[model samples]
Target: MIPPALRIRGAVLVGPQEVRDELWVVDGRISFTAPTGTAARDVRTVSGWALPGLVDAHCHVGLDAGGAVDRPTAEEQITTDRAAGALLLRDAGSPADTRWVDDRDDLPRLVRAGRHIARPRRYLRNYAAEVEPDDLVAEVVTQAGRGDGWVKLVGDWIDRGVGDLAPCWPADAAKAAIDAAHAAGARVTAHCFAEDSLADLVEAGIDCIEHATGLTEDTIPLFAERGVAIVPTLVNIATFEGIARGAEEKFPAYARHMRALHARRYDTVRAAHDAGIPLYVGTDAGGSLPHGLVAAEVAELRRAGLPAQAALSAATWSARAWLGHPALTEGAPADLVVYPADPRADVGVLAAPDLIVLRGRPVAP
Candidate 1:
C-alpha cells in the first residue's frame, strides 16, 4: 500500500548548515512545497527534528565471521541496520550474492563490492578471493567488474613466516592492480592495519582505506593531499586487544603491534582528521561485530576527537554526498529519521529515533 503524504515539521537538516522549518514527502519523494490538491486532513503530520537517513559506509550484509550467510541471515542483517536508521549501506566486501536485496523497497539500499581480494592464506579463511601477486591484476579486474563501482583489497595482514604484519602485495603489483580497477571504472579500497601498506596503496591512487589504524605524520599528509578517504571502523578496532591476546602465543610480534595500534587508535584517528584527510564512519559490522551499530560508530568517532557536527556528517550528509546518494533534497526518495531533539546538539539521540521514514513508509521504532 502506498503511504499517505507526510508533512514533516520542526527543523529539517538538509545539510550540516542548511535547515528548513518544514518539508513534505509526496508519493515517495521529497518536495519542499505542499501538494496541489491534497486536503489538510489527508496528509499525516510528524513533528520533530529530521535529518537524512544514516549511511553505513562499510558493512557486509551476506557475511559473518565464518563467511557468506544464507538469504534469511542477510535479510535479518538489513533489518537490523534499518532499525538503526542506516538506510544506505556500502557492502565493502561480501562473498555471497545479495543482489536480490536491491529489489526490495523495504530494505536499505546497498552498494556492493563483489568480494575481498586477498593473498592466499593471508586473510581470514573463506572471506576473500585468494590470489597470488602474479594474478592480482586479473582478480582486480574481475572483482571490479563484479562490484558496484568499487573494489576491495586485503592490503596488509599477518605474515606467519615473518611473525608480524606485512604488506600483502608489492608496491608495483599494488599500482598495477589499482590501475586495472580504475580502467574497469571502479574505485579501489583496501583493508589496511599497519604502516607499511599505507604509502604504497595511497601512492597507487586507491580511493579509500578501511581500518586505517596505521596512518602517521608522514603518511597523513599524503592521504590528505591525495584526498583519499578512510573509514577507521573504530568500533571494530576496539577488538584488536582480544585478537592480539588470541594470537600472542603464535605470533608475539604481531600481538605487540596490535596492542600498540590499539593503544594509539584514538590519536591515529584524531591526527588524520586534523590533517584534513576525509574520514567516514563504518562499524565493520557483519564480521564478528553485530549489525545496527551505526550510532555506536558515530559515538566512537566523537570519542576519537571529531567534533559533534563533523562526526554526524561522517554518517549523514557528507557521507551521502561521498557515496553519490541524495539526502533531503527535492525529488529524492524520502528516507529520513526524526528525533525528539536536535541530533546536532547530541548525536546520542540517534539511538532513539522518533520516526524512521524509509522511502515513503514510516517504519515502527
Candidate 2:
C-alpha cells in the first residue's frame, strides 16, 4: 500500500509531553521521526504533531451481531442471526468504539476482550454466554491465541447489587484459565468489584484487574508486589448514577447496581496510583457507558489526581504497551490521530480530533 500523507511538526504525545521535532508514515508504519531535519521519501509536512492512534484496551467491538443484549428469547432469538455465534458478535454493551472509530474516524485502534464470561442467568445474562471454567478456558484460549493483546476474566458479580452470582469460578478454574492465557503469552484481565472476588482473582495470578473495586489498604501492596495493572474504568462508575436512573424503568437491577458502583471510594485507584501501580483507562461502554466516549475516562483519571499527561499516556502509549506493542514509535503499525490542543494541558481536545490516521491511511473527514 502506498504511504499516506506524512505528519510533521506539532506536540506529539509519544511518552508524556515529549514531542519529537517531526514525524511521518510509510505505507502503515510511523516511518521516520527526528528533530527538524529528519529524512524520508514522499516528504510532505503534516500540520499537527502525531499521536499514535488511541488503543482502547477494554473496548468490545469485535463484530456487529453482538448488539442486542438482555432481550427475551423472541428478541434474542431473531437477534441470534444478528449475534449468536461465539467467534464474532460485538455486543451493544460496547457501542462506544463504533462511534469513536468506525463512525467518526477518530482513534487509530481499539482492541477488545469480547463479551464478559459469567455463569448462566447472570448480569451479562442475556448476551454474555456463561459457561463452566473448563469450557470457558477453551473459549478464552481460542480468542487469546489469536494474538489479541490480552484475555479478560469476567466474574465477581458482587460488584453489582449482584447475585450469589453463582459461585465465582473455583480458584483452580481461574488459574487454569490464567495459565492457558499466560502459556499463550497473553495476560489475564479480570472484571472484579469486590474484595473477596478480587482476592480470588489475585490468587489466580492475573496480570491486571478491570474495574477493581473494594480494594483495601492491604490489597494495593499485594498488587504492587505482583506487578499487576489496574484499569479502574472510573468514569463508568462516576456516571452510573445517571445510567441507573435512566434504566430503572427497564432493568431495575441494573439501575441499582450502577448506584452501588458509583459509591465505592476510588481510594483503591488513588492508592494504586500513589503506590505506583500501573493504570489503564477503559470506558466500559455499551451496557453502561455510551460508545466512543473514552475521553471522559481520561478526564476522570485526571480528576482522580492522576497527572493529565499520565492519563493521556494510559490511553495512548502505556495502553499500547500493555496490549503487547512496546515500540509505538516509527516502524510500528501506523495508527495515530492529530488534535487541535496539547493533550497534556487540555484533554477536552480529544473530543474533537482534527485528523485520524489508521494503519497508514488518513481517512478524509
Candidate 3:
C-alpha cells in the first residue's frame, strides 16, 4: 500500500533552485512542487532543505576492503560496505570485483559500470575486476547491454612492486570497447591518469573522462566538441596522498603528481565550465578515501568555480538524468532524501539527512 505521501515544506531545494514552499511525494514520484502559502492536514513539516538524492557518479567501496585475495576472504567487508553505501546511493562503480553483495537491500540503488576493460597486465590490475581477453568484449557488452548507464574502461593501471603507470588498453582496443558499448546503447567512461594513452580514448569517442589529471590543453577542447563529460576526482586523490604520506612515513613523487593533478582538476573543470563543456563530480574513493562522503565532490566543484546551485545540480537532477530517469513520475518507487539546510549554501548539509525514503517505504532497516 502506498501510504499517505509526506510533504516537506521549507526550503524546497530542488535541483539547485530553492523554492519557499512545500513538496508532496504522492506514491513516490513528486506529486506537487507548490508554494507553501497555506497549511493543510496530513502535511509533514520539514523546516530545512529538500532535493533529489545525490548520485555519486564514481566510487569504489569494494576496492577499499584492504587485504589480499587470500583464502580468508573479504566477503563481509564487501557486503557490509555495499549494503551500507546503498542507504544514500547513486553510486557508480564495479560490483564484479568485490564480493557480490547478497543482501535484502532497500537503500541505495546500484547502477554499476561493471568490470573495467583493460589489458591483461595493466596499471590498475590490482584494483580492476580483471577482464580477460577472451571475455573482454562480452563483459563490456554484458554491462552495457543490460542498459547499465555506462561502461568503465581501465586505461591506466598501477604496476605492482614498481608502482609505475601502465597503459591498459591500446587505441584499437579502446576503440573496440567503446564501439561495443555504443552498440549496446551505453557510454564508455575511461579512467585516465596520464596523457600517454589519452589520445586514443578521445579519438575513440569515449563518453567521459574520469580523474582528468593528465588532460592537456589539446584534449580539453576535443571533449567539448564531442560533448563528453569530464569527471575530475581531485579530493580523493589528495586524501589518498595524505594517508600514504602519513602511513608510509614518506612522501613519494607519486604524491606530488596526484597533488599537481588535483590542482589541474580544478583548473580544467573551471575551464570546461566556462567553455560550456560538461563537468561531472566523481570521487575515486577506493584508492584512498571513504565511501558515502561524496558531498566533498560538490564542495570541490563549487571551489572550482561552479555556482553552488550548479554543483548541487551535478549531484542530484543531473545525476538522475545521467542515469536516464528524467522524471520522478507517479508509481515510481519512493526514493526521497531530506536535509536540514540549504545544500547549495553548504554542500556539507548533506552529511546528515533528517529523513530518507527508499522504495515507497520509510527506513526500518
Q: Rank the candidates by TM-score, best first.
A: 1, 3, 2
Summarize candidate 3's per-residue lDDT along 191-212 as a digit string, tens digits: 7776666777888888887876
> After TM-score superposition, what is the CA distance of residue 140 in candidate 3 from its true location, in Å?
2.3
TM-score per model over all chains: 0.98, 0.76, 0.79
- Prediction 3 global C-alpha lDDT: 0.62
**Which residue ranges in model 2 land beyond 4 Å of their true spot?**
1-4, 33-43, 62-115, 133-139, 142-149, 158-167, 242-261, 326-328
* Cα lDDT of model 2 by residue, 204-290, tens digit: 888888777656777888888788888787866676677567778766765665566567546567778888888887756554444
TM-score of 1: 0.98
lDDT of 1 by residue, 17-57 (tens): 99999999998889999876643347888999998999999
List residue ranges in candidate 3 displaced over 4 A.
Answer: 17-20, 33-43, 67-92, 95-105, 124-126, 129-136, 142-147, 158-166, 240-256, 327-333
Model 2 weakest lDDT span, ten residues long: 81-90
- Give all candidates' CA lDDT scores: 0.93, 0.60, 0.62
Candidate 2 lDDT at 49 equals 50
